[model samples]
Each structure stands twice: as C-alpha cells, then as structure tokens.
Target: MVEKESSRHPEVALSLPFTGLWLARNSPARRVPSHGTDLFGERYAIDFVGVDERRRTAGHRDWRTFLATEPADRFFAYGRPILAPADGTVVEVHDGEIDHAGRRSQLALVPYMLGQAARVRQGVRAVAGNYLVIALPGGAFVALVHLRAGSVRVSPGEVVTAGQHVAACGNSGNSTQPHLHMQVMETRDFSVARGVPMAFRHFRERPRGARQFHTREYGVPAEGAVVEPLPLPGAHSTS
Candidate 1:
C-alpha cells in the first residue's frame, strides 16, 4: 500500500496504554489510513497484540488454532489491564457487549471477514464493542476499543490520569482475537470524527526477531515491532 501524505492535523502525544510486551500492527508510522480505510475514524488507528517474553501470542497452540475458535482467555492479551494513555475526562463509555471467542483458523476467519460489512452497518456498538472515549485538553479525543465485558471501571465525565487502569483487553466486536485497538480522533463521535495522528511517549521497541530494544522518546512504533513502555522510576510493570 502506498504511504499517505502527511496529515494537516497536528500529532497528539500519548503514553502507551499498557505495560508488558506487545506486538504492534497496522501502525500509522508505516502508512496513513493505517487500517486501510478512513471509516469510523480509523485512518490512524493501530492494534497491539499482547505477547510473552518469547513473543508468543498464546501459551499453547492446539487443533483449535488451525481448525476452530479458541477460548478468549487463552490469549495473552485477554484480561490484561487497559490504561488511560493521557490525562483526560471520560466523555463516553460502553460496556454492554459480550466478550467473544477468539479465532486463529483461516476457516474461522474467512466467515468473520465476510461479515465485516454487516458489522460496520450495525453502528459503533458492533464495531467498537466495549469502549471508552477520553476528551484530551486540546480538542482531541482518544478512543480505546474492543475492551473486555464488565471490566470498565470509570464512567463518563470522570477524570483519569495517564496510566490509570480503565478496562481490560478482550475479543469483542469485530476483533478476531484479544487485543487493544486505539486511535485519536477529532471528535468523540467516531461516526463523524476524523482521525488524528498520534505518537507514544517513552516506549522501548524491539524489531521482530531481534533481541535488543531501542528507546523512542516520542514516536509511533514501527509495524510488526514488539514494544513496551519504558520503566518509570517508581512504577512497577504489570503483566
């Protein structure tokens, strides 16, 4: 895919929403309209799949991995805490969706992909699942979607600080597996919002297959790279 030209909107700086290693996917640093479409303010959206020290997405792979759906709890990302990426006021929250089983098999994925259009047409609840929208100081809205059912802790209008735990990752909505899907947009209503470029602050990234990690002071992670937040002096990393 061709890289999109730079956006006219100023980039928003954010903190990585979770601790522990994660695999970056559909990164805006790789291309604009990062998810391959501009719908639902996803142009700059990115996905992070939780991984272990060995970079495995799950502890075990069995017949289900190749032929059917797996339990959502089997994935490393499932139930992992999802945090606030910046200090902001919660503008919206949705927690009514049920967490679904995860799919890895091509057979399973094919049918799911075919239903993409229907999901989109069903509106935000179908697409985003359990989610939260934070209104940042400068008119930017940060959204974190596909969260675990019943895990949301904050409500609309509550103030949250960066790194505050707000929910957990889950296989919900249009997700094929448990992961975090995040994006910054121009407005709280994603239906009419425009995606805004965003960068994470103070994270360390290791390219796939490499043992060493490099620190990024302020930047978007490269697609396919494994990343974790840089350790803070008094903060302990959680799984």
Candidate 2:
C-alpha cells in the first residue's frame, strides 16, 4: 500500500503485451483523443490487431465465412495469451461476454457500427467485453479489454509480474475481430477514470510495407505501425 498519495504521475513505460506483428490503430500519439466514443473515457486507448506476412488479419476465407461471420478461431490473434503490461495487482475482471464472430466485410461492419450507441448505453460489459483492470505501480491503472471467454488466468487481488500471461486475446464485447484494446487511466473504475498517456518500455516498430523495424527504448507505438516487444535479456514470451 502507498503511504502518501503522490500527486506527480511518473512516466511509466510498459512492456508490449504480445509478440509478433501487431498493427496499432487509434493510437493517442497519432491523434489526440483517438475515437469518437473515446471522448467518454478511452480518449487515449489503443487497439492492437495481429497481422500476417500478407498483412491480412485472417486466413483463407470461404463462402461460410463470407455469408456469415467467421469464428474468432480463424483470426491470427485468437487464443494468444495477453501478457501483463506491467507489474500490478488484478483490480477487476469481467469475463462473461461470449467471443463474437470475426468480420472483415463492409456489409457486416455497417450493422455493427450502427449498434455502437446501444452497447454504450448497456454498460462496460457491452463495450469492454471480457476485460481486466490492473492497478499498477505509481498509481496508474490499465484496462486490457476484449479478452476471450474463460481465458482470464488471474483473479482479483492477485499480484502479476510484468509480461506474465493474464488472458487471451478475443473478439468479445463490442469487438469485430480478435484484438486487444488497452488503455491507461488514473483509477480502476474506467467509466469515470480519466485517460493516462502510456508508452512501451522497449519494442520494435515498422510501418506497414516497411522492410525493417526500428528499435525504440521507451516510446508509444505509432498508429498503423506493426510492433513487437523486445524480450528482456533472460525472459521470453510466455505463450
């Protein structure tokens, strides 16, 4: 427990939660106050979606996948363990949302986009899906959102070390595909918590179509950039 509440927020850089080519979208560094709905609270949230060599978010598609949405299992990110971005205590967990089907077609996306308002009014479960809140050091809180159903590995109050496997990425809540929606905040209650700017400790980034990734010590991944975490000297990706 902290002895005295510190007013000055420290510059806390975290580990990128997963491995491989994850494309960042709606990153705060690229655009201030990222999404429209983000104006509510997730003003600085970043959405990470894994992509393959061809830059496709999913694999081969068939008629079944086109007419009806495909299962989350088809996406590259599905079932990948989401690592803890920093050492922290599990402050909140909500894992009841069913992993929704993946959608890449513009036809399916239209209806889903129209329903955003309803999900907003329905509450956090509808929007954040199966998510967890980590109360990190220096009084910063992080919300890892849209996890797969039943993939959470820790319970509330449990202490988690940085890079520990916490949950698997999924297309739950208001998500259309398997991806991780991460954001930092001042408090554990994200609904009322103000967004806190966050950066990664050490990672490699390459924009789409780039030949090489430039290594960065401590910085935020730019929007549309593909990133991967640089494993610590003796440690590697958990799963």
Looking at candidate 2, the ten consecutive residues that score lowest on lDDT are 1-10
Cα lDDT tens digits for candidate 2, 1-239 = 21212223454578899877798988876876766454435866889998886667887798746666787899999988899988889999998789998987777888999999999899888988999999987888999999999999999999998888899999899898999999887788866877777778778888866888899888878878888888877765453
Tens-place lDDT per residue, model 1, 66-146, is: 999999999999999998998899999999899989999998899999999999999999999999999999788999999
Backbone clash pairs for candidate 1 read: none
Model 2 misplacement above 4 A: 1-10, 37-40, 64-67, 234-239
Per lDDT, the best of the predicted structures is 1
Error (Å) of candidate 1 at residue 110 is 1.2
Worst 10 residues of 1 by lDDT: 1-10
In order, candidate lDDTs are 0.91, 0.83
Best of the candidates, TM-score: 1
Off by over 4 Å in 1: 1-8, 232-239
TM-score of 2: 0.91
